[model samples]
Target: MTRLPVLRTPRLTLRGWTFADTAAALDVYGHAEVARWLSPEMTRVPTPSAMRLLITRWIAECVGLPPPAGRWAIERDEDKRVVGGAVLLRLPPGHEDLEIGWQLHPDVWGNGYASEATYALAGWAFSHDVDEIFAVVRPDNARAAATVRRNGMLWVGETRKYFDLDLEIYRLRSADLKLGAQTSQRPPGHGNDD
Candidate 1:
């Protein structure tokens, strides 16, 4: 496993989560708007201390993560606040099942941050040797679906295949990286939150 490097887009900085980011992480992760679509592991951090502990664990865990598979703190470099977070990880314990996801504070929703953060993460992941990246969105999560779509991921429709829940699956081949709506100033329906 190689250390994941910081990734940046025109407006966002996808960097490793720091211990000092606890309060920001707590503020974003604790909000119902941000937590609603995230996994239980993210929404269930009971306290700031718990959040810090978990972030510490994740940072430690990154050491063993294969290339292009690590979590990032999504920062709007202009404001330097933690607007949300992004993830690029190998799903189900295999290197082939790479996934990309993003979460943004509702207050910052509709500003294209989710799409930007997600696209940046996906681009970085594609730079590695993997052939493709997948995004598993709950069937009902329209916002997330839009985010993936805007990033040029092709929908493979719904299935219970990956996370055990019925999810809408999407994929982007490495050859297609940065070739579509991902580099646009504002993708269609860009105001939606994830």
Candidate 2:
């Protein structure tokens, strides 16, 4: 497998995980509010051992594993602190699609990091031959849903997942590269940059 390369944006760095990031991961993942929109299993604060397992799993996936096609640690350019995570996973055999996901600290909630990261990841995925990219957001997560829409994804209705909960699905086809292009053309803080 080819090594995944690091990606940089105006104020963020998207790169591979490292053991040194444990503390940041613990802080972000342990926050209930941050995990609320994610799977329930991730909601509970994880112990050190559990965090180690999580980091290991992330490393495995970053190495081009089956479950996670790609995962990046979103680091702030100023402090180089790990503020969040962005992931792209290949759907199981039957689904044959790609899924994009992101999680950030509440402090940066309104700053457009999620939207920028999603746009970058979606662009990267399609550039590498992924046919489609989608996100399964909770219906109540208005912020996340808005981010998806801002990135040019269309609502594909709702569906139940392994977690046994109904989720709103938003999708963007490879042909829909316009979203990424539009996002790239805008300066930060103007319009769809959010």
Candidate 3:
């Protein structure tokens, strides 16, 4: 498991999570609007301390050698604060397909941050030799589906492959990516000089 590199887009930065980000993590996860899309059990983590534990574990697993595929914080470039989170993790159990997902602060819902972060994630995965990256969304989550579409993913209908919940899967290949994806995701230790 290679570590995630710090990625830059025109408007946001994608980077590793740390304990210092716990407050923003809690606020994003605890919000009813954000948690509604996640699983029922996830909604129960509404406290900062609980978010701290999750962040601590995530850092341990993902910031080390053989890091498990995991989420990275979506930071606002102008403010240097985490306004959301994005993932490039493998699907549970089988770990066959890499899944891409994101949750943004409700205040930033209509912005294109999700799409930007996802594009960077897809590019980074492809650069690392991953063949297919997926985005699984509840059929009703039009916004997420739209973000996948913007990143040039094709709808694969439905499946209960991940989380044991029926979901609409969107897939993208390295070749399917629009221009600039390959160059956008700089390698680990490679600064986002682009």
**Cα lDDT of model 2 by residue, 1-194, tens digit:** 64666878778988888888888887888888787877644664577667778888878767755433687889989998899988887644354667898889877776778876876787788777677788888888887887788777889889876346778888887655575457545554565323
Model 2 CA lDDT for position 54: 86
lDDT of 3 by residue, 1-194 (tens): 46667888888998899889999988888888788897433664678889999888777768653432567898999988899888777677697888877888888776667767777787778777778888888888777776577667888889886778888988898776774354434442233211
Q: Which stretches in model 1 have alpha-carbon errors above 4 Å?
A: 40-42, 93-95, 187-194
Of the pair 1 and 3, which is ahead by lDDT?
A: 1
Runs of candidate 2 with Cα error greater than 4 angstroms are: 66-68, 92-95, 175-177, 180-194
Better of 2 and 3 by TM-score: 2
Instruction: In candidate 3, list every pair of residues with a backbone clash.
Output: none
Order of candidates by TM-score, top first?
1, 2, 3
lDDT computed for candidate 2? 0.75
Residue 89, model 2, lDDT: 76
Q: Please, what are the lDDT tens digits per residue for candidate 1 over residues 1-194?
A: 55768888888888988999999888888787667777634554568998899789889988888777888999888889998878887766344688888778777877777777766777676667777888888878887787677667889888766656778889888655566453545542455443
Alpha carbon deviation, residue 104, candidate 2 (Å): 0.3
